[model samples]
Target: MDEAAVKEFIGTEISRSTVVVERSAIAFFASAVLDDDPVYTNADEASARGFEAIPAPPTFPFVMQNWGAFAELQAEGGQGAGLGMVLGPLMANGGLILHGEQAFVYHQPVLAGQTLTGVGVIKDAYVKESKGTTMTFVVAETTWSDASGAPVVTTTFNIIHRK
Candidate 1:
């Protein structure tokens, strides 16, 4: 995936002000991931455990920042293009897209019902030649914050588009 267009995405803020975090979203994500953590599903359990409400499990922020409003973000008037948009041009150029890596760091627990905002940027885009193959790597970082502007979680996504 050596298209110049894909390279232009480096440093681009692909997603901004993504969506708010809610209790239902947390519970659903927890269920989908088979977390089965009471803090993510039961408000009473979370409260008894010293949380104001059901607290999201780790990695919940990524769910809200990525798939939460992905449909809207990929369309016109949203970010330049969502993940799929970037993947298309890459795949068309004899490249294969793969999930390279992912990491998350939590500064604070994301509370249920708190309206949150997210921002993401294509941190880097580069090509590497190894094993007689040329591989393109795109790394993105998205941070979710609370209404008070305190960051809750920072997630880094690494994608490999290989040819």
Candidate 2:
């Protein structure tokens, strides 16, 4: 892995996506994740729990890019330039990329019927040697905000490339 080449992407914006949180999608995700919480499925229960609408699961923001309205945006190339634009060139010679870790910071509750805009940026990049293999780690952060531009969730994840 070319550490210097990968480092060039640090502090760069890699992806921007718009996701419309739907109630049906939230119900499906909650079911798939084995979360049988009524608040995730019943709007009345959610409201009684002090939420304005159905509340998404804690880690729901991570999958927002794969489902919801983001799916349509992805087809139309609305996912900005994508992560491939940053990692593709660095791995042209062939290397393995792996997901390392992920975390989320919630500033406010994410309801099922809100639209969010996510902006991703490369936070940092570095290289390390383990068992004689060179590994390059890249840290990326994405902040999802509501229509009024208030942050709902900020997700940080790590991607590792090895050759």
The prediction achieving the highest lDDT against the true structure is 2
Query: lDDT tens digits, residues 83-155, model 1?
Result: 6656777777576778899999998888876766677888888888899888888899988777788998899
Could you tell me every candidate's TM-score relative to the true structure?
0.82, 0.90
Against the unseen true structure, what C-alpha lDDT does each candidate score? 0.77, 0.86
Q: Report the lDDT tens digits of candidate 2 across residue range 113-143.
A: 7889899999999999899887888899999
Candidate 1 wrongly placed segments (more than 4 Å): 1-8, 66-80
Model 1 lDDT on a 0 to 1 scale:
0.77
Error of 1 at 37 (Å): 2.5
